[model samples]
Target: MMLFAVEWQPPRLDTGDLARIAARLRGLRPLESILDDIGDVIGDQDPPAAEAPVLAERLRGDLVRLEDVAVAADDRDPRVAHLVARARALRRREAPTAAHPVTVAHLRRLVGAAEALLERLTETGTLRACA
Candidate 1:
């Protein structure tokens, strides 16, 4: 029997790739506010059961888009990877019936990760506009 192991190599992001990532990050920023508004609505009153699921689905879509950018950027940061995994898990667990509390928490974490990644890009000089 032969055992083979494949090593994961991070892709080198070129100038154009970095620019695209910056644009994606900018796009994701609006989702944070959307999530906050949904959270507030959930907290303020008893809304229809369908409301949360709709918001959760939207958040899931945003997270998936962010995840695509992170993977493209070849982000190796442990925190970013963890958040991506959480987002994936949340997406997998999404149910049409109701929104789970865990989903909300994951969305918050994913948003934070997006912010952190943007900051990381700036710190590494990958995103000059952000700096």
Candidate 2:
């Protein structure tokens, strides 16, 4: 049953590089994109209630995107450290489970937090300087 063995490693973080890149005029495009996806599920144009399974799947996927940014951020930097802390706190709430189904309201909180983080990054970041 054994094929080949593979090793696992934690993600490597290089905040300086990330900041320099994100600070580009192009901006936080990836982060903004995930926000749009989350919006479709929670946006007013959509119905108040969504199917549980679909909502859960979307919720899990959005969290994974946030995790990517969190992993790549350096905690030594105060701004990114704060965002990372907020993301970890959200994780403590945990992802959706059958025993503890989450609602759109929960997703709203996540979206709000994410938007705030993005605002902070763009506002204080090098993106401002170049413009």
Candidate 3:
């Protein structure tokens, strides 16, 4: 049997509803990358007709969670806020192509956005236990 590696979903956005919009300025860890990776993988899947939309919607919900956390935390740092904006744009772009044109470059861009957010959070200590 081919074994699939189990991945853990970080708890940055779910740390706390209130903490979702907070501050961090020390170099710790990056959580955005995790979110992005999750989205990229989900968006790139070729599930059966019954499962494709469900997977897409789940991925969208995850992105929305990050967006909500970022918006809540934007008051803490503008970089995080900007990351949120980029993620939102990517989400919108992915929605149209969820089951059609899932390109490698597109995946890279999505992951890149997440990486950028992680770097900012790590440098700023916004993602500690969350990462």
Best prediction by TM-score: 2
Model 2 C-alpha lDDT per residue in residues 53-111, reported as the tens digit of each score: 46545555555555565456532447656765775576457545433224555656666
Ranking by TM-score: 2, 1, 3
What Cα-based lDDT does every candidate model obtain? 0.58, 0.56, 0.57
Per-residue lDDT for 26 in model 3? 38
| Model 1 spans > 4 angstroms off | 1-47, 96-131
How would the candidate models be sorted by lDDT, starting from the highest? 1, 3, 2
Q: How accurate is candidate 2 locally (lDDT)?
A: 0.56
Q: Candidates' TM-scores? A: 0.46, 0.48, 0.45
Higher-TM-score candidate of 1 and 3: 1
Query: TM-score for model 1?
Result: 0.46
lDDT of 3 at 128: 55
**How would you encode candidate 3's per-residue C-alpha lDDT over 40-114 as one tens digit per residue?**
455646344554445455544555655665556554787777877887888787544444445444554555665
Question: What are the runs in model 2 whose C-alpha is more than 4 Å off?
Answer: 1-30, 45-67, 70-79, 95-102, 126-131
Question: Which has the better lDDT: candidate 1, or candidate 2?
Answer: 1
Model 3: clashing residue pairs?
21-72, 21-73, 25-124, 26-124, 26-125
